[model samples]
Target: MSKKISYEFLEGIQLPITVKKDILEINKESERLLFINKIFQIF
Candidate 1:
């Protein structure tokens, strides 16, 4: 799933992704969450 995300509260989060591959990238920098209100339709 290659979907772009835009939010309001992405400040300072942490992501220790050692094994990099095909994965959904999200900003984990501040107060905002990595995956919050996103819904996927795999119907």
Candidate 2:
């Protein structure tokens, strides 16, 4: 599921470099939130 999103976000190789970088940053932020949520659920 995560891989799908990452691939979709990266599918447009012709986009500006900065936009691609921002997409990666957003992916990282979302993954971080998911990690935190999982940790909280473990308790």
Candidate 3:
């Protein structure tokens, strides 16, 4: 789903290793926040 699309999009970008890792870590944090928001919405 969206995960695959994001992975491919990241792969398509030609960035340095450190930058890529930082971007990925930020993305993971955002995704976690989104998940928490969804849980709050359901409550």
Candidate 4:
């Protein structure tokens, strides 16, 4: 999932460093939201 995406981005040498960092941050936020949603669903 996210790991695969991050790995692909890391391998993309043509992409700027700032863009890669931004993408990673976005991925983290999405993952965090998904985790929170799952917790709420359980309760």
Candidate No. with top TM-score: 3
What tens-digit string does per-residue lDDT give for candidate 3 at 5-30?
44555587675777556555645655
Whole-structure CA lDDT of model 3 = 0.55
Candidate 4: regions farther than 4 A off: 28-43
lDDT on C-alpha atoms for all candidate structures: 0.28, 0.55, 0.55, 0.55
lDDT of 1 by residue, 1-43 (tens): 2232323222222323331111234434221223332322221
lDDT for model 1 comes to 0.28
* TM-score attained by model 3: 0.44
Give the C-alpha miss distance for residue 23 in model 3, angstroms: 0.5
User: Candidate 1 — which residues are off by over 4 angstroms?
Assistant: 6-12, 19-22, 25-43
Q: Each prediction's TM-score against the native?
A: 0.18, 0.37, 0.44, 0.39
Q: Candidate 1 has what TM-score?
A: 0.18
Q: For residues 1-43, could you state the per-residue lDDT of candidate 2 as single tens digits?
A: 3545554645744656775565556556567446434545987
Worst 10 residues of 2 by lDDT: 1-10
